[model samples]
Target: MGTTVLEEVVRNYRGQPEKLIAALLALQRHYGYLPEPALRVISQELRVPLSKIYGVATFYAQFRLQPRGKHTVCVCLGTACHVRGSEQIFHQLRRELGIEAGETTTDGRFTLEVVSCVGACSMAPIMMIDEDLHGRLDADKALALLTQYRD
Candidate 1:
């Protein structure tokens, strides 16, 4: 293709130390995680310390230095979600996937994480499988939803 996403991110924000956070976010978006090589490039181009860049990356929950699975499964454990039996759905997912929260499956197809909220309280007991929002889920429904993503 054309210039790689990392190249674009670096070139667009080259020598702009103040834009480090934005640059890291852009790189994360492009690759789903921050690749170490990209970080080195950012350090060299932006003239910023690699330690500083890494500090910012580790400070934010949104950033992932390691590669995430193809799909991210976020379960809402907010007050409303908990009240609506989200734990039951979470249990189902854990059982079916054989992985607990904060762990990825052996196949690298799914990563299960628990979040405080997805900001959709009205649709409590919700989970997000990638970009799709699934609300009003039960044990069976959660398992079925996960099944479709295996492909």
Candidate 2:
């Protein structure tokens, strides 16, 4: 992890403390995850402490300390969705994506996440691609849905 991306991102923010989050986000986007080397680079570039950087990274659900895929698939595990077969949907996605929950595909094309709820119980067994919702999903439907993003 060189300092190039971190340095450029911090430079764009003019070293403002308020831009720390944004800078981290940009850095993460560039590198996929905030590795220790990158975090050290960021800390030095922004003149912020390593502890603070780690704190921010760990505090946010959106931040990942490990690599992630290009597209993230979130399946709802809320009571209603579970009752409606969200588990089967999750299993289908795992099989198709070839990765378990919280893991990214070997090709780095997709990541699977299981959330407690997506707040679309009426459309039980809902799954999300990025932020778009697909409701009333099952194994076949989920497989078809994922094919659209495979490329």
TM-score per model over all chains: 0.83, 0.82
What are the per-residue Cα lDDT tens digits for candidate 1 across 1-151? 7999888988899999999999999999888899999999999999899999999999999999887888999899999999999999998888888988988898899999999989999988899999999998887888888889988
lDDT of 1: 0.91
Top of the candidates by lDDT: 1
- Model 1 CA lDDT for position 46: 92
Query: Which residue pairs collide in model 2, if any?
Result: none
Clashes of 1: 0
Local accuracy by lDDT, each model: 0.91, 0.86
Clashes of each: 0, 0
TM-score of 2: 0.82
